[model samples]
Target: MRKPLPFGISVFVALMLLASQAFAAPKSDLWPMWNQSNEANAASFDHQKWQQILDKYVVVKGQHNLFNYSAVTPSDKALLDQYIVDLTSLDPRNYSKDEQFAYWVNLYNALTVQLILDEYPVKSITKLGGFLSFGPWDDDVTRIAGKKLTLNDIEHRILRPIWNDERIHYAVNCASLGCPNLAQTAFTGENTEELLNEAAKQFTNSDKGAKIDGNTLTLSSIYEWYGVDFGNNEQAVLKAIDVFRDGQKLEGWSGKIKYDYDWDLNQP
Candidate 1:
């Protein structure tokens, strides 16, 4: 009989496999409980409080935006906390799809800012993770409708699976410089679609998003991480982002593909 591997080696191998799987991008699996939406519900969720928070802290610099994390006052932090509490007080499943869309987006962004604030002075959002961890994405951030939810739960489970929109990658900021810019304005039912298109355009045009030099095409790791959402194949992925490209399109020429991401905190 073959001897069993040493306990230390066995544990190490298991941990390594678990770490690899944890870092892989999550699939868009629907959490059916959230799929309920009442199209007849005409009342819109108020996002002005969230907008005020965004307007006060978000500093727009060219195509990118940064948040002044250190400058936030205790009073403002309290207001942010209240905003989250007010959001979860109501059952979003009773609202319309448009209302739900804006609700989730604002909630996600607000929660992300709160997470960074909770651990301010950190070099990267990834540093917020515990031992042998990547980031706080999996940490339970809040409870909505009595269901505990994480950042990953909101993005991958609720938003991505429900909307099935690739533009979500832009709207949900990751509190990192490499991720798409966090919008300065709060997303509303009326403005969500417009903002989504604008974000797609801006990120695609920015050097941090996509840069093509000669026959080499370099893209943000967002594409590589969630390439399936854009379209599994390279050609399809390029086509998906092509419409948003402001410069010479990546049509006609075949080039090498490369992916990179910056994990520095998106703070000023």
Candidate 2:
């Protein structure tokens, strides 16, 4: 015979379950329309403007690369707006997978920057969300090929499901200090793989990503939130981490695994 939890304990457990469900990470659900790609097409989209913006505004300040949101001039802001317009105007499905990968990654990063610029001086990106909303992720930020898309749509529904690359986590920036650094150069088909590898290495080695203390292992909440993408268990997650760790292999640390994240804006 099993003993039932006391009434107060049962209520607390129920509340905890509700809280977990409320903050659960979005799943990778495919949007078939985005899966359409023309492998034979040999055209390259221009990302020069985006590269210019990143080069000028993003600076390496300690371990993380922070954006100079406050330093952006009106002309530069206009340039960024035009760059986004140019990106959304194209139908990415008309390009090959390599090109599409770069396009979506750049678009997602640009849109996130634009969102922050739109609501600048806020301490965090979460401030953009209304009382009922957690963040502006669900808001339609752009239109591509006649279909409006939210950040969540581009990331979870399109990129994650279509590519099935775990490194995609490193490529997309959430405008948060805890997130993987927004690459200094814009992602292009020719350089995405190199950049992805670099970003993964940088993040995994940085304290923001993982820290092994005494006998305990503490990691970014990302690995916890998207555990399935990284392999869905502690050992599997450690294995994924091992791939990018710069130093010695993560060995037998039979201690608690704690996850933490800082939502503070990744801006100077």
RMSD of each: 2.7, 4.8
lDDT of 1 by residue, 177-212 (tens): 888999988898899989999999989998788888
* lDDT of candidate model 2 versus the reference: 0.90
In order, candidate lDDTs are 0.88, 0.90
Structure candidate 2, residue pairs in collision: none
Error of 2 at 152 (Å): 0.5
User: Tens digits of per-residue lDDT for model 2 on 191-260?
Assistant: 9899999999999998899987887778999999998999867788888988989775664447888988
Clashing pairs in 1: none
Give the C-alpha miss distance for residue 179 in model 2, angstroms.
0.3
lDDT score, candidate 1: 0.88
Backbone clash tally for model 2? 0
Model 1 segments beyond 4 Å from truth? 1-22
